[model samples]
Target chain A: MTVAAEALAGRSARRRVRETVVTHVCLVIGVLIFAFPIYLALIGSTHTSGTIGRGDVPLLPGPDAVANYAQAWGIGGGRFMGVPAGGMLLNSLLMASLIAVGKIAISLTSAYAIAFFRFPGRMVFFWLIFITLMLPVEVRIIPTFQVMVSLGMTNSMAGLVIPLIASATATLLFRQFFLTIPDEYVEAAKIDGAGPVRFFFDVLLPLSRTNIAALFVILFIYGWNQYLWPLLIVNDRSLETIVVGLTKMIGSGDAQNEWNVIMATAVLAMVPPVGVVLLMQRWFVRGLTETEK
Target chain B: MATLTLSGVRKSFGATAVLHGVDLAVRDGEMIVVVGASGCGKSTLLRIVAGLETATAGRVMIGDQDVTALEPADRDVAMVFQNYALYPHMSVFQNMAYGLKIRGLPKPEIIRRVDEAAALLDIGGLLDRKPRQLSGGQRQRVAMGRAIVREPKLFLFDEPLSNLDAKLRVQMRAEIRRLQKRLGVTSLFVTHDQVEAMTLGDRLVVMHAGHAAQIATPMEVWERPADTYVAGFIGSPAMNFLAATLEAGGAAARLADGLVLPFADGSRAGEAGRKLTLGIRPEHLRPQTGGLRVMVELVEPLGAESLLHGRLPDGAEMTVKLAGAVHADGVLEVMPIAEALHVFDGETGRRIEPLG
Candidate 1:
């Protein structure tokens, strides 16, 4: 028998079907719990723009979807107090890109150094980086904001990107992943006259594509979903991101609020990160499980 | 090929010194195997020669150039690790071609050289296969191919065949010897197995406790060991040792239980009445009708011979490699006649060279 057939032969047809049924049931329940709020918001937008009560659920998508999207993007906003969700969408994309690229660049080089080089104080530096992960981000918010202000980086993507670049957790993970690679490959490359940089880019990076992809997915989602720091720094309506835009949509208090528009904006804002998750679905699972130890 | 020379090579980690001032010369096209027990610094000496590791205080010369400060790549040498460190992601062809590619050889030249080396190692069929797909012996051949394709001046092997099974290890050992002879690169092979050293190396360096006990031909080392360690380590089932003293005017070895073995030569030189160790090979001892009375403890029968492990008088251990299947009876008088016993200084455990 073939290896795949032999592996599957141990389980009976009944057991396989039973497992599939249970997995599908759990997924259905989870989808229902998450999708209910968007349904109500969408229905609230359709019913003359004020019927957001939970008792009446919409059987179909609301007709006011396009109108709400335009209003959220500030096509008909009275002033700029309501964030331009279009500009926020663009900021989220640009900020997430900068944070992803910068974090990967820094983490890759740092991980390479810590994992391979025999520099003095390497262990001490690695321990220091590891210790930073224990301090909660919330506790440092006020000081971090002041530091950002002093650096004149208070209201830009750089402001969003730089504070996120000090991530010791990502650096530690990448270093550990680099460590799992056998020293033999690096040694062989060195014996072939490969320099340190050549070893990283040529040997190490090629072998770590899936890992990089996985970390990109995770960090992109993290930067996209970030709130408190951006809320404090980005008071300008034009600079607010998707999360802050969603918060404004939820907090605005007029009786005729279009819940459908808010729900559509929320779902649209989540598209890119969700797309990243689906694209790197395999690598996300593999990389996370691989770096567990 | 280049002549590799190591002078005053010493290595230590903190207070623990492993290699103590080893000096040796490896000629071009010669295969030298450093044989020793574990932690005896054989591998350390090989690494220092390859420039993979730095010596505490030494001069490493390749041909006429001093490479003490140069890295391994600058040394223009290649090594085969014990674990067969083939790059897992690359095919056999790529692994063989990697060094040449690093040196920026032309594409055709790299392919030609890799193919030639693979063919030489009888791994032509396995070129496109990754290392994981190949078996143990195949992986070993590919590893050798990786080293010799560059026509390096020196080849350093750190127990290359240690990971193979017994039968395959012997086969690969012979193959490696043949390959080294064909390539004519000066090679330094480190192994804890004396049998591998004897079969594969032209000259053997026997080490003990960070010291070179003897560096000579394998036969010379086996026949005339410099010390008790070499004598004991070079043979299988090991050399049997008994506590004794030289008496009767240095003409004989006197056992504590009154078993006197007279040397064929006149006397044991200046070692008269001094405490000594009686060394004997198992094959040298036999069960006679009546010579010395002893009891049989156990008899292990091989297809060709039977090994008897028992005690001599005064409760010291002894072994006898006799012919045929012999059952273990209670008592037997095993006689060891003239010229079969070896005598050594008991206090220092140093071999006492027999008188002419």
Candidate 2:
């Protein structure tokens, strides 16, 4: 081996080693940034009130976690405006389920129509529905509120569930996915003597389980973490959702501010979302490329 | 198997018409192929028979029943799509058994039918495998297997081999022909490949623009095409055409090589210089010691046979099939035989009757 060639190879090896270090450093830093806040939230949920207020990092979780969670339910919050934390959790669950299920049911039917059947004004109808998506929910809040009040649904979960049932975004996404399926599958089923109803159930729906699961998880998370709409609809404390309920626990009267109780409730609220994402993680990455055919 | 008939059937999408009024009778147990270029409406006619598309105006009768208005399922027909369109979610066994299952066939019957079709297609080993797990030829076989299990009154194939590789396509084409013959099922296959049409079809229906330009046995269509369009499309390295006007003794097919084909079409006697075009198969332009002279510009030898690309005196590029090999460098002689010549009217491009 020549000295010059050895030095050249060594230099290149050194450069590659340096590059590897930099890449690993960036990856570790990115992971930390993304994960640290969730770690803090979980840790904060476990601390004693004084430890939580110190607001310094807890190297490990404190021992008062069970006590904090119980306190968050208003065993110590003074009467708490008629009902307790358990009732509020129930209310949020009902509202989110109705919204998720309703959105998927309606979206599936509309997507099937837009993707498969040819009817007069199909394109026009889709364009009209899609135009609603352009109007941000913020701009329509006034109208949405007025409709809710007129229907006597104010202060009720119905106000939160029904008005937001039609999701044009989900419909459009599902429709695009459905359109990639070959028409020949439909025709093949037809020639086999299956009618439209049978074809939709037997052929289309079974093939779309992946897309449906991905959509279900996405819409479920959106419903579970909804804030502004639920806050606006539920004025009474008992009817409050997890997010609204968590907010009212501030300055919540203790030896020190009970940040632990508030954080515990927040942690519980995060469960459904994290579960949904984990369940559909495979499909989430796959959604973009599955229709290459 | 049932005899299929179409009478005065017309189909149009808005202002664009696909299948013009046409009549055809497909004999029971006969395999007929509809061949044409991309927009020739052969697929459309097949779809109408499958009940996938409705005919704008007329009746389609299958066996003794009129099935023009019934849906595809109601009509007793099966179609194999070009893309194969095998249900990705279903296994091969399920794909073949789907139609029978839908019809409420017993479990034993469904299994037996699926097994029979799979065995026939030689895909019995792939019965449990999903479509994605199989190769292109296997998927194609599975598609045929699906259609076969149904035992429909008619089977319609729409360019089913277009997606396969060239070698596989040829092999599958032969396999499908053999299967159709063995089944002796009434079938209509649509394809753009003249070779497949010639080999698979007991009778060939040649279409152009939306019209059935010629309908006859494959040999008949090849030997005697109805017009210039049919002549050009039905043969590979397509039939050559030359332009000139009709002459007194015979029509003068003036070539670009400054030579004229003195074809024996005497119907236009004393009508010299009448606009005309001469049609000749490449094999007919013999490289003999006679007729006209053409400069051999290029030579493409295909082992046993070769193609001689040359130009006539009038500058029209021409190709001639040479027997064995020819060592002509920019020079060759070709005798355009009279009996082998097909003379057509230059204006209408229709075959001119020999007046001798």
* Best candidate according to DockQ: 2
Tens-digit lDDT string for candidate 2 (A144-166): 99889998999877788888788
What are the TM-scores, per candidate, against the unseen true structure?
0.89, 0.91
Runs of candidate 2 with Cα error greater than 4 angstroms are A1-15, A54-59, A70-91, A154-157, A235-239, A252-256, B244-275
The model with the greatest TM-score is 2
The DockQ assigned to candidate 1 is 0.41
Number of clashing pairs per prediction, in order: 0, 12
TM for candidate 2 is: 0.91
Candidate 1 docks at the CAPRI level of acceptable
- The lDDT per prediction is 0.81, 0.82
Candidate 2, B1-356: lDDT as tens digits: 89999999899999999988978999999999999999999999999999999999999999999999998888878889999888888888988888888899999999998889988989988989989999999999999998898898898999999999999999999999899889888999999999999999999999998889988999998887888998999887888888766545554555544556665534554466777777889888776765556788988999888988888666777788878987778667788777778777778777776655
